[model samples]
Target: MSPLKPAFFELAVRADARWDRFSRGVRRRMGLARPLRILPYRGYGTAERVLIQARVLEDRFVKPSHLRRSLVGSAIASYKRYATVEIPGARVAVHWGDKRWEGTTDDEGFLELWVAPPPGVRPGWNVVELELLEPEPQGVPIVSAQVLVAGPQAELGIISDIDDTVIVTGVTNPLKRAWALFLTEHRTRLPFEGVDAFYSALREGHGGLADNPIFYVSSSPWNLYEHLDEFLALHRIPNGPLLLRDWGLSRHGFAPGGGHGHKLEKIRGVLGTLETLPFILIGDSGQEDAEHYRTIVREYPGRVRCVYIRNVPSRAQRAVELERLAQEVREAGSQLVVVDDTVSAARHAAQAGWIRWQEVPRVQEHQQEDADARTVLDALGRKGS
Candidate 1:
């Protein structure tokens, strides 16, 4: 399919407005009036401009039952208990520094405003305040979301995928992945071995103070933002802005590609905005990441320093396709490495002078420990059987 155009999104916004009006009419007929709420997800941008986005929803409380230990139970609880009642055609104001931007929520009860940051705003973890101005003054019901601005001192930008690349979400397997997502809590879920060390080394760069900006682009929906954010912090992964998609139905129809278009658009926007900084593209081989990264490498030429694909067992059949993409990436003046583990990728980065070589053993040790733990678990399972 062709890339999504600005007009396409505008049309979607209009459709959402119509649906919101219809839904409100039905609510009125049913004599139901719920309080309005604004749910803003974290966003990222540069010093020049920042993107602030939020969803305006009616307040709907669903009390939780006792937390479950199984993955399926947890997943069901999260989906059923956590509330999302989008309020379409709602107006909200976004304030960052001294500047303000006003925007109305679309059919999905989502509002996104791109506003220029103040001239002297520095990089690293800046907050943008949001307020609801429509549907009878709901007060500041939402907390401010953070926007990470890449500063001039940043050596290179790192755009990484979140699923199997960082955390083991088993994206290649529907059943196992579902179990992990719903059954396990964020704090309990484990990241790939040595991912933290590898990313930390990349963030520090050659001089150990590059403060290189890292942007996490994920196919996961915005509803899971808090869960993923907690996972990142728990694993001590390098912090940055998260680019996530909106779930649920859209105006046009069912999104056939399962958000590949949305992922591509967000990645392209980030690449275009941070034109000066070359990026290290990191993702897993389980999905179309290799395809997307190859397209990015070819599209932007030397702007991409390297493409790292974490090899997964399920995608072993795609080796040929990955090889072809590697050649394409090389021809485009960038390198592509299909690594079996995070340590391999870290070693490559160390050799390239992107990180210190001394850190390689630390990453390897972490990987080995994870392998040992898994082996022990497998042995115990066999014995139990």
Candidate 2:
């Protein structure tokens, strides 16, 4: 399949609008009832304020499945069984620490509210209760979500990409990427070698008291939030708020994959919120991460401590482009290191005093073991094929 261009997405937007209108008309004529459901996603905030977002959708039940399953079976189930029935014009009430914030879902059935955290609301995971408040007598009562509140003690923050950075999503090949996304299960997916250790070390920091916040900014759609969240926990990666994009069509246009503008905006929002702490940016060379990070480093001089770009085979030829970007980042007051593996990144982090020097050897050893495991898995796959 060829890559979709801007014109294709524009046409998709028009088609989607027509379909939506026709569906609404038919539903009205048939007097079909729509079920209501509230889906509260993980949120992030600070001691001063909290940001919470959720979507109102037509009710649909999804059965919980075990993490361990055949890749093909899992992919089939996910693609066929997932539902995204948005219900617009719904009012939602969010309660946290003696405060209640009310907001209405937009045309896309999404609601986002920023509320001040009351006194004595400490850091760590804070649970917020959400209830659908509109359409009297048919509202969802209690749906809870945890929000990570960054404390004042946090020394620095970490912003990293998802696909091709931590997990192996094969973004360079559209066909293979689609297959990995729709045909495989989260448990069956794999992360790059030593990423778990490298990220954990960043989270712990030098004295193990950094309690540094980590934010995962990914181009993946919000629908895959649960899957990615599970992958992180299962692989022992540090937990953080996932900033994902909505892949559906809206009044503006159809955004199949989160555009570069969307990603930059999301990253800027996080940087704006955490004004005091500097950040370490991590991404891969597979996408426009180099360009985006370059802009970030220029826009927020002295705020970005280090920029790490993990090399992908398809992007190897862009070494010159990356070198230029590296110079740009350096001129803007930050270091950009283009490395082929996570162990090198770990070593750099150690030298920069972001992590302990002793952790480097452990990361190196684990990476070697991961490589061996991959060799075995590849051999087994070949035999099966």
Candidate 3:
């Protein structure tokens, strides 16, 4: 990595911050600044400790439209997410049933509070209420962040990647990824079909009764957190804590293989946190997911039950490399199955007795339906053009 790259990136970030501060001041003078809202992300924890992840962003999230979106509308909504202004140094008071804790937002308007779990908290969704108490209370609204506490009966925890594995983001292909990020609406972004069924099956560990926890660990910046969350919920994917990393400021700067260490760190952190439960790691062959997951499988020994590598269509070299890593995973007393789609992974899971054998057909059926719908949509789009 060039030494100047970090310097230049810092310069750009500082410039953007200066512009935001200046523009925000102007908006305030004109009495037109966007309202301050507490944006709390979905968090997960154990019975003893819970993490609360949230941000203080200008209240500018565009409500996603249910009807088919025009390209213009999609572009506008997508751009609004990226252009959000952060409100730093805000004091937020967090409240959970009988417990209370307070924290201040950082320079990026983000807060992560690790507090003792509220007494008598169950294994399912628990609520954490956040109220912005400082900055003179512009309406001082209390917002709820649903935090999942894993139950002891969980057969195994699942850790998944979002981009390419779950959705069709051409991260390796810059132009395609840029279009998907900047213009594609959440409703329009395509998810890997049958993934919902497959994930649901895994989530239902035994006899369709287990309450397994799934955590999505992605290198995609936190700026896209809400978009990704909405996409998961829209597609009926089993929701979990999305552990996305922050943007830029990496030591490698823009160099290839810069940002992916975040995935390894997050994955490891999840495994370490829930020490008793083994994990099933799911990611795509795209970029470094395979490499990162393989590291977990080897390092954690029998802690990981299996690793599923979704084979996204791209360079042949990635496929070959992933095939090679499968042996390493198996040698570590675990399996890394490189599958072409959701159906294949579901089949493997069923055979492994991880999911009911009945779910195989449903996964296959959903995959076919999703593929057919995509074909129809493509044809319609071409004709319209």
List candidate 3 segments past 4 Å from native.
1-30, 61-63, 248-257
2 against 3, candidate with superior TM-score:
3
Q: Specify the poorest-scoring 10-residue window by lDDT in model 1.
A: 60-69
Query: Can you give the TM-score per candidate against the true fold?
Result: 0.86, 0.89, 0.91
lDDT of each: 0.79, 0.80, 0.82
| Each model's total of backbone clashes | 3, 0, 0
Order of all candidates by TM-score, from best down to worst?
3, 2, 1
Give one digit per residue, the lDDT tens place, for model 3 in 1-385: 5788778877766665566668878998999988889888998889988889899888885765665268888777767776777876778999998778889876568898888886778998888899988764778589999999988878999999988988888887899888987777677777887888889999997578888999998777787887888899888999899998776443335423455887888888788878889989998877788788888888888898888988877786776787788887788788888888899899889888889999899889988887887788779879989
* Total clashing pairs in model 3: 0
Which pairs clash inside model 3? none
lDDT of 2 by residue, 1-385 (tens): 2355656756765565456546755775797745567878878878877789888766544445583366655755666334575655678888886888888876667788888887888877799999888743264558997888888777789999999998988988999888776777766677899888888889888877778889999878777777788899987889888888776676445567445567798899888888888999999988899889999999998999999999997645689889999998988999899999999999899999998888888788878876787788778879999
| TM-score, predicted candidate 2 vs. hidden true structure | 0.89
Clash pairs for candidate 2? none
Per-residue CA lDDT of model 1 for 239-303, tens digit only, reads 88788876655643444335465777888988888888999999988888989988888889889
Number of the predicted model whose TM-score against the real structure is largest: 3
Least accurate stretch of 10 residues (summed lDDT) in model 2?
A: 59-68
Candidate that would win on lDDT: 3
